[model samples]
Target: MAPQDEPATTDEGFVPLFDGSTLAGWHAAPRTFGSVWPGGPDLAGRADLAQADADARAYPARWEVVDGAIEGFQDPDHPGFGGYLVSDRTFGDFELRLEMRPDWPADTGVMLRRRRDTWHGLQVLVDHRKSGSIGGFFGNGLANFHAVPYVLDVSTGADGTPDGLVLEDPATTLEPMTPDKPARLVRRGDPEAFLAAWRFGDWNRLRVRCVGAKPRATTWVNDVLVAEIDLATLEAPNYDADAVAAFLGRSGHLALEVHDNDPRFGEARWARGARCRWRALEIKELSPGD
Candidate 1:
């Protein structure tokens, strides 16, 4: 069924992307990596957005609308079929704001500047597992950017490992890390202040800004600047820096990822992995001329 047509704009210059009632202007994509990327099976069978939206709406076990929020679930009876809900419209430079809360052990993220055929793009991770690496960049098939505290404590160290079991206090130093590139300790912002401001057990405000020309991306959690990365300068082995930089300039859709869990981990694990909720998604377009 086609979603009801509604005004997707507001007076505040923030466009309503989700409409809080329907999945209009959005297409459901299967898990971008294992099922849709390089050498992967094509799980995104149909090409139409309405069909994809219908499929997602029908299977509330995977994606559903609840009280104005987009929710993803991993029911024991329905597992492993995970993917992303991608916006049909493409955006260039923009400021996006949203609130998200993941269930315990669930993993999810907001992906931006994504290419159409594959999931090669940047993402802000909402990892709620014991990993304790929330609000980091997932990189998808591209690159991962993370900010870690510089201070000594139990939950973190200079090497990005848990030095102790207890976090006595917030660390003052926030550093950038690219574990996939084996890179670490790149200074970014005030980690301690970000931690002190982060509110657990509730919806966390996330804001992302992109330049798209030179391709500088910045992320904030609960209004605290946690990471800023220049895609043009990112050093990733086996990846073309020029191509990566060019890819960032391409306008693409905003996708909400429904993390795919390994089936080998069993249904219980899958159920835990697919739980997340998002709300208040709004975006303001910024032109180069502006």
Candidate 2:
């Protein structure tokens, strides 16, 4: 079924993340990675979490509550600035649900099990740009494994503004899989169904359930199942599930990202002055019985 503008009925045991007025339980952690693509941060060594806690206070994003929703954008003074509005509390196994509406040419995502120090975790890609994909997974620091069903570009009208979205074959736009570096993982979903369920130029509901140390993440777009990844049983090259589990542990904070616009790409990663709006953010913690 297609998602409606009205918020989903709150399920039992679910709790609110955003207070709808202020960012009380959140902090900003700016990522200083040279580039956010291919691989986000080095995972060869563990970062000092204590030091990261101290450093996060210094950097902040232009995130604020507007009309009962959290709006995030890049700083106009420092266009190159990019970071996440991170939750102070960490989660282990949980089911997360939210609604997002991003402007054209925006590159933002929901970070899962993210480290406090850097961009290391599983990312649900909301790359609303050329050659980007929605409802997919990106391994931020785990060998850059991309598990998307299809790539997408903006469809433009005569005036050169975005009119709709155009779906493309991933094979044509993304790097081919190889033995040494198999970057792309198999995604579970029908592309046509995803397109039909997606609501262009409007708010879309996203649901994600992640569990275990080496997690099994399942995603839904407007209630259509789009992606499911079992990290422990994954067989992609250079993706070590055990190592990833060890590094990240069983719990981490949830984050909303505002990516930097790199000069090498020629075009901005995030559109100038464009902001992504989020609302109805909530999560339900899962126990062993669940």
CA lDDT of each prediction against the hidden true structure: 0.61, 0.75
Among all candidates shown, the one with the greatest lDDT = 2
Q: Per-residue lDDT tens digits of candidate 1, residues 177-254?
A: 324422422335566766676655568899988775645767788888766666666655434456565755568778
Candidate 1 global CA lDDT score? 0.61
Superposed model 2: Cα runs more than 4 Å off: 1-11, 34-60, 169-187
Candidate 2 minimal-lDDT segment of 10 residues:
174-183
lDDT value, residue 262 of candidate 2: 57
The predictions' CA RMSDs to the true structure, in order, are 8.0, 6.6
TM-score of 1: 0.72
User: Which stretches of model 1 miss by more than 4 angstroms?
Assistant: 1-12, 32-61, 143-187, 247-249, 263-274
lDDT of 2 by residue, 120-145 (tens): 88999888877777788887876667
| Residue 199 miss distance in model 2 (angstroms) | 1.7
Residue range with the least summed lDDT across 10 consecutive positions in model 1 = 169-178
